[model samples]
Target: MLAGKRVLLIIGGGIAAYKSLELIRLLQKAGASVVPVLTRAGSEFVTPLSVSALAGHKVYQDLFDLTDEAEMGHIQLSRAADLLVVAPATADLMAKMAGGRADDLASTLLLATDKRVLAAPAMNVRMWEHPATQRNLATVLADGVRVVGPNAGEMACGEFGPGRMAEPAEIVAAVEAALGAGPLAGRHVLVTSGPTHEPIDPVRYIANRSSGAQGTAIAAALRDLGARVTFVTGPAVVPPPAGVAVVRVETAAQMLAAVEAALPADAAVMAAAVADWRVANAGAQKMKKDGSGRAPALEFAENPDILATVSRGALRPRLVVGFAAETEAVVDHATAKRLRKGCDWIVANDVSPATGIMGGAENAVTVISERGAEVWPRMAKDAVARRLAQKIAEALQ
Candidate 1:
């Protein structure tokens, strides 16, 4: 997918900077020409000679090198690439990008580049989770920068959490997904996944059995098809897919807000298993049992119906799909739901205990549309997602 592409790769300072060498080799193997830019601190880990040798190009480092300035101006160098990638994007680098600081060659190129940028963050666990770093991340994301991972594992600091940079293969895959051309190219799709948690008290809440595997698969499939996806997900056991804009939320109301914020898409898939009701009279603290042995009175309120709202909203997409996980009469209930919710289609599955479909790897689904129901045989959720994504691509076309 990256054939004939020009990638301006900025190597950031971190132990993960060593991985950028492998990333350069992988990018070259994928048929992309890499222009290396090494940061001052980055040189401590990987030498510019090795980077330039692997990339087969001059490594750019100084912002005011007279020879570089005379040969090719910074503006041209920055704008010449199809995409800019920052491997091992340290917290400091990300903060600089967010704050628009251009004190160095790398940050200057990032600031001057008009092309899309992708970052593979690497930092300490505490640094990754810091509020300032998270704010900077959110800022960069809102500015259209794509992120791959700071996956969870043992860190070089002897700490374990989410701060490791993504593997070279994963970064390459994300680069391909970012630059790929396919049926859904230039399209934007919104997807919701997982189960919302309705807080009942400080220590307890109500949730469902949704693992978010199917929805994650669907988002990845859409991304592979070249669509820009906004994945609004609730508290899910399964992590979200790469190469998509992810918005995490805890409650149904928060999910609804996130969904609404990511509006005016070409298509929307409401795959979340939202709670039907929430505790209206939730306790400020954990509700304690009285000595009389009677439970406290709890008031219930209806949660927002995301599917129906998205389908009927003013900014509704051309195609709005919903999912129905029913225990009985799945097809009938799903068909009725499609009509009642005013959605274009409903992907329904029987999630009874006997089926073991919910939170399971496999799925047996029925697609309900205006024409009727089309039953599909049991298969892996990934397969289901690919088929459905193809259908969505066709519909959008």
Candidate 2:
């Protein structure tokens, strides 16, 4: 999405400063040339040589370097790029920006820049919640500086809260959004992922082998295309992608509710492996052996058909896609499922033991629609996701 853009990246001081290197690589891969600037404190964490090598440019450090001043002044340097990105935007740096302090090259550039600026804040939880920092945040936001994340999680100090810097991929999404790139821009897509667990009891439950790899890849691909994604996920081995609104659920009924709440979307991809049944007469405590040599009788109840519900709902999206993981009759079953579910399309795949697709990294899918079934070659799940995202963009367009 960032084909011809130039980005000015400022690496600030913090343990998270190391992520700036990955950010540089991602920006470069997205077709943007990066001009890196390292702050004095930032230098202590990552060397200028490392940043320069990754960015493929000289790392700017001093505000008053005579040679740099002779070639391109700070003002020119500030306005040179289309956007300025501050990674590991320390509390101190944010305070400086808010108070109009220009004691260093990084702050000076931020002050002189006429271009858009995006900051990724990273700090201790208490410091982030501090009144001074909050006030600074408010001031910078009022000044029209874009911010990405300080996601809640465990910290380097053995503490936990919303003080972690956003992952590199998340920052890239924010950049794409800021630049207004990608075909899916201004579009909203809902994605359901993972396998739901139907509780037989508090400790034991019925589950599946789904790793959520495909679904996670799909969400990331959609985000990269500039779509605002709402990811409703079940308990799975894979982690949800960053830069998307995530709603986590554990049962088919809960997944359906989350999907409904995320309504009015342009499109929806139902990729979750929701269990078909639940124990209707589950025991309050763990079921114990009675020594009768007979198993306990458990009644089975059907789970909510999420795809069908969405397709027939009043707030149905423009396009509804479902997934069918079958061990037999994959094509025939998927084609019938498309009609039965009333969805626009169904992506069917074989997940038999021999296929190794149940929890594998690769996928071979057959996309069934009213038109016909189109078989796709087996490939990495990520590649499949990118292709599907592109198709969704085209369909939406």
Candidate 3:
């Protein structure tokens, strides 16, 4: 989507400034011309040489460079690019932008830009959630600036929450959305991922070892294709991607409700590892031993079948995709599951512990549809997601 377009990327100060290098590469690889603008604080984490090397363009940093001003004035520079992006849009930078500060080259260009601006914020979780930052964010948003993510996850400060910068792929997707029309443009997709916890008590629960990497990848992939994605996710180890509406749930029941609420989607992908059963009589308080020399005998009740329910619902999505995790006869099981669940397609993978795919980074999956099954070679989860998302684009078309 970025082919032949020019992007004025302003790198901001933050640990995530390093990710801008990769973002530049992804942009260029997609045939976009990248113009580098590195801030003074941004240079603290990444060198000008490295930024210049990756972007294949000279780094512009000084606000008053005589040669630069003589050739391309700051205002002209802003007008030249098709889009302006700020990765690692730190709290300070964003605050300044909200206040229309043009104190330096980066801020000056941002102030001068007549084009749409996208910012991917990165900061400490507390700072990100702070009232001042929120006010500034609202200010920028009101200024017609678009925001990607300060996704939830582990941060550089050893704290875990919603402060991490969106991944390079995710930011690239947002950039594409800002710049041109994508394959899934104007489409809405709903994706469920991660493992649901069937609580036995406040302190313990039942859950599978699903890291939600595949689902996260899939959501990112769909977004990259320009789909408006509603991601209904569980407690995933990997954080949710940017540029999508996320609904967090803990139980299968909650997931079902969230999915149903996010209906009217063009497509739906059910990839969560939902527990089949939840405790029938979950105790309000933690269970205690009474020195009876016996463990508690708990009863179980079937949890809502999210995939089947959504597939069979009156508001069924146009394309319903489910997942089948099997230890044996993966394709056959998924094929049967597709029919049984009334889904249009099924993605099957072996999670037999031996495969190490349950919580692993890479995956080997078989995509089963009504036409037949297609065996996908073992590869990184992101690649598989890209392929599946492409298939979805074709199917929807």
Candidate 4:
């Protein structure tokens, strides 16, 4: 999506600055032109030569370099790129940005840019969580700047918390979400994900084993295509992708409500493994056992069919896609489901334990439609999502 685009990368000083090298590689791999800007403190971590070599563009460092100024003024340089990215955005750098400080070339360009900016923060755990840093973060976010991560993990200081920078791949995804051809641009997409829990009691519930990886990946892919995505997610194992509106729910009923509320969408992808039933009469408190040998019987009630409801609603989206996780006759079941649910497409997958697709990392799907089914070979869920999103773009267009 980023092919032939320009991204002005500002490398900030920190141990995490090293990851910026991989970030540059990934950005270039996506066909984005990289223009590097190294700060005074950033020079301590990575040599300008290294950054320049990887970016294939001269490092823009000095605020007063006569040669650079004569060729391209700072304001012109800021207006030249499609985006500005700050990897390993230190607490100090973030503070400066929050305060609107433009004392150096990096800060000046940040202040001067007319394009959107994405920051991947990297700091010590305490520094990241400190109230001051939190305040600065809120400030920057309020100013229309998007932040990727200060993911939780072991830092170079041997401290473990959310101060580590996001991986190069995750950062790349964030970039794609922010700046891409966005074929789905100006389109609103509603996506549901994960397994919905049907509460039986305060402590017990019925649920499925949906990891939500595929749905999360789909949302990211759609965002990369420039869709304004409303992600209606259930209690998910994986975190929701950044830069999308997330409405979290725990039950199928709640998921349905959220989906309905995000109506008039261009497309809807119902990927959640919503439970088919909930307890007819759930206990308000924990059910205690008396000294009886017999067990209590529980009555079942049908759950709200979120996919069918949205597909058949008065405000039905232009494209409605459902997922059929079947143990046998994948294509047949999915084809039937597509008809039964009144959805445009159904993604069929085998989850018979041996397939390892229930909560696993990869998937093999057959897309069932009115035209027929198309079998897709097993691949990572991310690849499947990209393919699905592209298909969605075509369908919507």
The best candidate by TM-score is 3
**lDDT tens digits, residue span 1-397, model 2:** 7989999999999999999999999999999999999999999999999999999999999998999999889999999899999999999999999999999999999999999898999999999989999889878877878776676678999898768898898788768867878778999999999999998888889987789989988887787678999999999888777668989999888999999999989999999999999899978999998999999888999998999999999999999999999999999999889999999999999999999888986789999988999899887686688679878888999
- Could you give the C-alpha RMSD of every candidate to the true structure, in order shown? 8.1, 10.1, 7.8, 7.1
Q: Residue 379, candidate 3: how far off, in angstroms? A: 1.2
Model 2, residue 178: what's the lDDT?
71
Q: Which pairs clash (backbone N, Cα, C closer than 3 Å) in model 1?
A: none
Better of 1 and 4 by lDDT: 1
* Total backbone collisions for each predicted model: 0, 0, 0, 1
Q: Could you tell me the lDDT of residue 163 within candidate 2? A: 80
Compose the digit string of candidate 1's lDDT tens values, residues 317-345: 99999999999999999999999999999
Report the CA-based lDDT of candidate 1 relative to the real structure: 0.91
Question: Cα lDDT of all candidates, in order?
Answer: 0.91, 0.90, 0.89, 0.89
For model 3, what is the error of residue 390's alpha carbon versus the real structure, in angstroms, after optimal superposition? 1.4
Clashes of 4: 1
Ranking of predictions according to TM-score: 3, 4, 2, 1
Pick by lDDT: 3 or 4, better one = 3
Tell me the spans in candidate 2 whose CA falls farther than 4 Å from its real position.
1-5, 9-66, 69-178
